[model samples]
Target chain A: MTYCVGLLVNAGMVLLSDTRTNAGLDNIATYRKMFVFEDPGERVITILTAGSLSVTQTTIARLKDAVRGPDVDAETSIMLAPTLLRVAEIIGNTLAAVRADVDEKLVAMGQGVSASMIVAGQRRGGEMRMFLIYPEGNFIEATEDTPFLQIGEHKYGKPILDRVVTPATSLADAQKAVLLSMDSTLRSNLSVGMPLDLAVIERDACRVTLRRRIEAGDPGFRAMSDAWSKALRDGFAQITL
Target chain B: MTYCVGLLVNAGMVLLSDTRTNAGLDNIATYRKMFVFEDPGERVITILTAGSLSVTQTTIARLKDAVRGPDVDAETSIMLAPTLLRVAEIIGNTLAAVRADVDEKLVAMGQGVSASMIVAGQRRGGEMRMFLIYPEGNFIEATEDTPFLQIGEHKYGKPILDRVVTPATSLADAQKAVLLSMDSTLRSNLSVGMPLDLAVIERDACRVTLRRRIEAGDPGFRAMSDAWSKALRDGFAQITL
Candidate 1:
């Protein structure tokens, strides 16, 4: 299980993901789920993935392979894609293909391959966009009405997003909403752990602007956690019979 | 879809359930999921059901029938159960049997029946206990660690419970936690809808002491909802990037 959320706000875009991946309760491991592709100053794309580590790691490795390969056309590559939509399509196709291959090999043991991703970014002159790419080579764009996308262990964190998020929100506020959302998830679910990966992309910048890693004992996060605990206690106290 | 939650605290047991039932997006209706059986001062058992409405309604109806019959016994009754544990066992066995019977008729269409329930109450001179009963006649008792149980649209509302709830929480506070939790689910899931039934049984009282129905236009609920929205917005503003 994992938790990844991406919000497209008027000022910029905020993306956050937990690094924990567990095959079982005793087999938990930390693995970065955020991937960035940058042709700096021209285009910058970030992919946050969730699900089976094998499928996620393989799909990302393949995408990196495409980036380092020859400058193929859009039909043959993700880097040459003209738009974010096309980039998402390419990612979805690759993810689906990787899943199919892995699933086939695992068939003997009756295993399965499952993975999904949040793909968001901007081209030099194109608008900042976000999408949720499914494992079946399909995707849905986040529009003004929704403005955000979440994947994996999503339900536990969804309430905060529903109550506080909107497209008109500022990038700074969006960052807190997402981090708090991730905090709520990490508290309730054992499969989602710390050492989170957070990234911010200012609209049309075509480069990563803000990036931070929140470790287990980070003071800022610790303060936020304590504040939330206090707020909940106070809030509960104020409610009447 | 449904959303039902129960909290066992030192002050009492609080049970809340939404009355919405849906076969699909196009087919939704109002169907009460909370059933209370009490012989005041002797025993009180509130069962909050989720999953197959047919299975749950039938199970409750059967239990009612047995209680109303003169031949009541531990082998065929809920009202005569010796302890809250036995009461939960009776409900679980009934749910599994009802599910199996309903499933038999739907097997040709490849459909199935299933139900889960939260049983919370006390028998005279016994402790206030809570059990989350599964469709297979198996159940788990709530501990100080978990403290509460939720069924149906659970994910959307779990964060708040994980944060502020505890075995020492007051009954009134538990009600608020559950109502806010249900409100969170209502916003995110259209399948879970209005007209909630709330029941409170004081610890060792052996019967439901208070009950309320919050309709769609209930003023008190509306006020609480608005206040919660404002609190979330304020919280978002108070946090720095």
Candidate 2:
């Protein structure tokens, strides 16, 4: 299982994903899921994926292949897609194609492969839009009322985000919201593990302003975990029957 | 969709379930999900179910029928069950039977229906026990590591419990933990709606000590909602990336 969250805020976008994948409990492995496509000042599009590693890894390989291809164009790849929507379209097409191919092979063993991604970023002039792409290739955009989207072992982490995240939230705070969100799930579920990838794209910067990898024993994460525990205990105490 | 939580703390057991049912987004309605069977001071059992209403309601009806029968016995009923575990076994078998019957009818239409419940309470002279009954009649108890069980739209509210709950948590604190847990899910999920049934059973009481139904505009719930929103905003501001 994996947990990936993408938030579109007035200050920027925050993307976080855990790197644990498994065919089963005993087959667990760490595999990073955040993919960044950047032309530095020109554009910075980040994709955080969850679900089948086969589908996401292959889809990402194809995206990278397109980026390196000499004939890359608005119609052919995310690198030159001209708009975030077009970039999403390009990614959706690539992901769907990869899924179809892998699923066909897995059908012999009665297995099905599926994957989804949160695509978010800023271009030289366009707005920082965020999208939650579905396995079927359709997508939903994050609006003011609900400024974030999450995938994978989502339930355990969703509460904090639902209560706190907003478009007007600061870039730094948004990162904390996602981390605390992920922290919640990590404690409840064994399928989701550590070595998290976190990226912050400041509004209109057209580049990732900050990137972090939080490991199992990171001090900052440890502090946040401890603080949250104290807060929950206090909150419970203050409530009346 | 539903959100029901059952907690087994040292103080006792707390069972809470939201009363909302929806066949589709446009066809939502309120339906109680909690059913209590108590020969007060003797045996007190409460079931909070989630999933297909048809299956769950039917199962509860059968159990009620057995309890009301004059020939009730361990072989034929829950009222005469030898132990709390036996009562759980009876409930699980009946729930499974109901699910199979409803699922068979729905199979022709390609629709699926199944349900699960959190059964918690104590029999006089017996230790308090809690079990999460699955659609297949299999169940697991709440251990020290996981002192609570939540069914239906569980993810949205799981963060708080992960951060704070333990078996030693006081009953008062556990109650607040669960309400906050449900509050998070209610905000994020439209399918899981309002008017919650909350029951508190102090350990060894063998009877409910407190119970209340929270409606959409319930004063206490409204106050908690506002306070939580403020605390989350404050918490976000206090944290750094």
Q: Candidate 1: which docking quality band? A: medium
Q: Which segments of model 1 are wrong by more than 4 Å?
A: A239-241
lDDT for B52 in candidate 2 is 88
Once model 2 is optimally superposed onto the true structure by TM-score, how far is the C-alpha of residue B99 displaced, in angstroms? 1.4
Off by over 4 Å in 2: none
Separate clash counts for every candidate: 0, 1
Worst 10 residues of 1 chain A by lDDT: A232-241
lDDT by residue for model 2 (A1-241), tens: 8999988888889999999999888899999999999999999999999999989999999999888888876787787888999888888888889899999999999989899999997789899899888887888899998899988888778778877777878777888899988888888788999999999999889999999999999999999877776766665566564
Worst 10 residues of 2 chain A by lDDT: A232-241
**On residues B135-160, what C-alpha lDDT tens digit does candidate 1 reach at each position?**
99899998888889999989888988
User: i-RMS values of the candidates, in order?
Assistant: 1.7, 2.0
Per-residue lDDT tens digits for candidate 2, residues B127-197, read 99999999999999998888999899887787777767888888877878888888888887889888999
State TM-scores per candidate: 0.97, 0.96
Q: Name the lDDT of candidate 1.
A: 0.88
